[model samples]
Target: MRTATVSIGVSNRHVHLSPKHLEMLFGKDYSLAEVKDLGQPGQFAAQETVSLVGPKGIVEGVRVLGPIRKSTQVEISRTDSFRLGIKAPVKESGDLAGTPGCMLVGPAGTVSLSEGVIIAVRHIHMSPKEAKQLGYKDCDRVSVLVEGERELCFHSVIVRVHPDFRLEMHIDTDEANASMLATGDQVKILGRTQDALDLVG
Candidate 1:
């Protein structure tokens, strides 16, 4: 409990747009920023946020993806959600576990795909040095406080200990809002922290 590990979770909104929709928003000035190598098989690993031609909207950053079997997701920060006038819950991306989805109205037409911008939350990978110092393994579960209503505890949050992932907690847009947590909010692992240990679900 001597502050060996300090992890923070940052959540973003995900909205799955259609192929045509993707091109429409970013066809003109879409550029790839970073490609994250997810150890997935046979698929290319790249994430891009496109620049829509606009003084029309107050939003930027488009995360691009290859063809998928399901919906196209657009991740928005809490601030971004407010700017877009999208009334969505600030739940964890995984919190909307088995929900249908939501839609977005663009300048072109209404892009209706899903109901909520929450889905497929993943673990933030960490370096071995960090993991060893924290006494964590590649898939250790940490209890995250679920925001709102009840003082909920999210159990089994996976830890992907590795050298590549930077130290951070990764949550979807939903979680950030429900917890009313913003950028630079301090969070830690839920064990023997005294102040937070008792609240760990």
Candidate 2:
């Protein structure tokens, strides 16, 4: 078994609202801030709270992504949009080419997507000693079986073996739920032809 852990990044966000919707939410005075890389056209500055006015119902507190286009997004809830004022329930950020997502948990919710939030999933960083021992190659689909008070098997996890990558597995909240897991908890790795033997990290 490989003695390493992997971590993955996962986030959920809504699509940016259109111009018409922007006019409805933030009055037409606001404009979109031009961003680079994954920034989609019509991407606007979200002022924290807005309404998602969908045909079905509305989701309140919808973060209005400025510079509205055709598809507007309501990030939080299928219900929030309905009770408040929104169009769709929950539109995935993937619908838009360049919009991103971030959530702040404490008392007041004030947070934005990180610089790399929109790009790809976060992975475990490794070192040469770690990689050679684990027999992991970049882009390898590796499955890890977790045994704790409860037993689970996580399958098809991507093993990113890099010279600089440290041994660890990355999982998101959603993925954690699938295995009923927790951080710092240990899992058993089963497979591969690598020969570095270490029972613990």
Q: Highest lDDT: which candidate? A: 1
Predicted model with the maximum TM-score: 1
How well is each residue in 138-163 modelled by candidate 1, as lDDT tens digits? 76666555444434555456777656
> 114 in model 2: Cα distance from truth in Å?
16
Model 2's alpha-carbon lDDT is 0.44
Candidate 2 has its poorest 10 consecutive residues by lDDT at: 113-122
Please give the lDDT score at residue 161 for candidate 2: 54
Please list the residue runs of candidate 2 whose C-alpha ends up more than 4 Å from where it truly belongs after superposition: 1-124, 192-201
Question: What are the per-residue Cα lDDT tens digits for candidate 2 across 94-172?
Answer: 3434443333221222233321122223234446576567776665555566666557665555556545445555554
- CA shift at 135, candidate 1, in angstroms? 1.9
